[model samples]
Target: MSTGSLTGRVALVTGAGRGIGREIAIGLAAEGMAVGLVGRTHGTLSDTLKECVKRGSRGVAVTADVCRPGSVREAVRLVERDLGPIDLLVNNAGQVDAAEVPVWETDPTQWWRVVETNLRGPYNLLRCVLPGMVARRSGRVLNLNSGFAVRPDGHYTAYATSKGALLQLSDNIADSLARYGVVVLDISPGAVATDMTAGMPMFRDNRTWASIPYMVAVTVDVARGRFDGLHGRFVHAERDDLAELVEQAEEIRRTDARTLRLRPYKDDDPMV
Candidate 1:
């Protein structure tokens, strides 16, 4: 890819105020993508916008609830007005209500909230933004997934279910839109050190892993078409050991199935 591969490209990232989302947005900006930052928190959005501006990328912040269609629509309009047409979308906004409640004791409202933010939020954004991408015949959609999407813990039914659905959602969209030049991917970054994980019981386990910057880097690389051939696949940071993680993802795409597990390439023990 050229040095200016992402130059002039507009990207919208939801839940971009802190942690993984913040890192993803900042990484994209550093790669020359104009960014639209979305979050419910004004202060956090300000911080993220500041980081993007510091990297010399044009950025605008939108305060909206990802669960609400009207709110997402308004945010998209504001972003288009300020940053031009969106060339990429990172559906990163989500919640974890079920992570804290037992499956039997979980309230219907909380379960729905998680499903809404993790699954429906992406659907909302895609419904609003996909037309533009399809019309242009060039765009990228990258959604965040969790390790639990494949191997769930005891009580995170809502999160795990939603993420699993998101994986299929990405695959279906990519398949339907592949001819249009738009790409979709579901990426699980492993156990990233974020506010979400800092307090989780898993963080105390010997299996605890540090967050890798490759995930954020690859997200930008995907948007810039550095890994165009990898569309419709799932990627993980552990592939960093074999080659550029994104490149490995592309090679995996050439095989029969779109789903690829990345742990085998890592140097560590399989149990680790």
Candidate 2:
């Protein structure tokens, strides 16, 4: 599918109120897709919808917490009622640790809150949205993942662990939906300068930040089916050479190169 092919398709974007989510919603609208902007804040979601409308696309702003299954179900109902059956779903709502502290020092409640927002939120969305997609046998789901998922971070354990689980979630769903003609992908925006990232100490002195437009462009490309061959793999907007990755898609599939896995102790290891 090309950008033109996305015209009139419906998309539901969680966290569409601000940052990368807002930009992605606008990008899809610019391509002529009707978008459903889902977020907790009505004001921000409304602003996003206005931006979408300015691009000559239809949109609806629905305030709902993605962490709650019931709320997600209602949100999905409203979006589909206003736009139509969702062709694309973007799970982008997430949170980070309150402070850079070791797991032992982190508040258990706070830790679980972050985990629920980042992991359970996407699971709720998938539960509410996938049924229609599976029935139709045509849709795409994009889980906003992170590099931390593959690397260890002592201070951001909750964030890292949640993202890692989300990666596995995408992989599992992709395998299940493969024969159904549905696509699932895990995309990492690569430390973009957002309100969320501004609070991170690691990025405070960093000179380079990921490009919002670049990430949005990559998202639009994925929505256009440019990277469907890489379904279930992790795509990092900042680090990846997308075209080259597409060229190597078959090789990637054969090797299971991008999905999460455990490394064997040696060549003779049974796990291998």
Candidate 3:
């Protein structure tokens, strides 16, 4: 869809206080979409809302913890009341383990906390926002996933597990909502230089970081339906050539190549 096509549409973005969420909200706003900034801190959410307004788009700042069902419900109600029915939902709020440690060594509370935020938070938002989308028979949902969702990470077990589950959630929801004209996508920004990444030990010595502009561009493309063909699949902004991906989308869908699946030991394996 073109920039003009996006005008007057509404988007609800969690974790819009900072990092990738903040950038995505601003990007969508630049395209003329009304934005609802959801975050735990009012100051940061307001900061992002200001940027959206500065871009000549309408927006509202909603301070709410995504992990809480009541808060998420209220947030959705408020955003819809203020901006109109949400045309898009961006589940970007997440958290990593406080320390990189083996599962056995990880604090149980902290592990659950990470899972609650990364997994439950999105579920909450989906539960609250999907009804309207399905009722209208038009909407898009983007989950900010990670490479860890597709791979194993011994050090950040909680983070990895939560992301993996989130990917499955996206796939299942996409299947259930397809007839309703609701699309769901899992997008990974790679290792962008964000406060979250800065706190991770793995990137301490890494000189390379994903391009923020590129990440935002890909997100905007998804928001505009450019990547709708890849719905219910994974998109990695830093590693994927989107144009090439779009070209291959049909084949990818036919082969179910980008989705998570159990690999059978052999072609004749019973699982296959």
Candidate 4:
């Protein structure tokens, strides 16, 4: 928190072409951090990269499918070669289920695609770039998450299952990487208006949307190392107060709040 601005930090945001990812990139750049844009589409990536440059910060866009290992590694190489070592990684790239369906009624390929993109995408990015963070003993990672991770959704089975799995991934990484000066978090941006949610019947109009500023603020805090103590926890922008959450770090740790866990089934369940 000593540094007022993210002036010298470098951030890589996947799915940086549109929606929340684009906003995060531009917001970080406005704070004076150079940004590296990654996504599958070259045109949108260029557009976002241009927007970041307009914020008085440098940026580079590297096209890559996060689900592909070779491509993800190549992205890291290109970004580091131009933007310097990435100090922060915003794993914002994600996919929505092609069609909302019950688990038994889902198309197998489409279901797997959702899981692969949402879960394996981050896994690939971490496998590629985490080693550098460990070697330097410093870095921060924020996984774009969703309330569905913890809440059961009858219709959005694939998306919910993937996010639920990702929450545990964040917890595991946070525990393993904290001693290396690396912090990891799962930040749910709430009900943001984005292409992924554009077709949802519940959001037929332009109302009941989460504030973009709220999501951006949380990202900035993570980038600035302001909430390192809340590492490995789930942060829901719609319900949790960031300031208050940070203050309750001790209690959170004690109670194991903001993480996925199993119910004891019975108070005396020793196996649990």
List the pairs of residues colliding in candidate 1: none
Question: Which candidate do you rate higher for lDDT, 1 or 4?
Answer: 4
List ranges where model 1 is wrong by over 4 Å. Answer: 1-5, 98-102, 205-208, 239-255, 260-272
Candidate 2 local lDDT, 1-272, one digit each (tens): 22555797999999999999999999999999999999999999999999999988999999999999999999999999999999999999999998899999999999999999999999999999999999999999988899999999998999999999999888887788988899999989998989999779878888889999998888888788898999899988799999999999999999999999989999999987
- Report the CA-based lDDT of candidate 1 relative to the real structure: 0.82
**C-alpha local distance difference test of each model:** 0.82, 0.92, 0.92, 0.89
Clashing pairs in 4: none
- Per-residue lDDT over 1-272 for candidate 3, one digit per residue giving the tens place of the 0 to 100 score: 23655798999999999999999999999889999999999999989999999888999999999889999999999999999999999999999998988999999999999999999999999999999999999999999999999999999999999999999998887778989999999999999999998789988888889988788878787888998889899988889888999999999999988999989899898976
What is candidate 3's CA lDDT for residue 200? 98
TM-scores, all candidates, are 0.86, 0.97, 0.97, 0.96
Error of 3 at 203 (Å): 0.6
RMSD of 2: 1.6
Q: Which portions of model 4 miss their true places by more than 4 Å?
A: 1-4
Model 2 ranges off by over 4 Å: 1-5
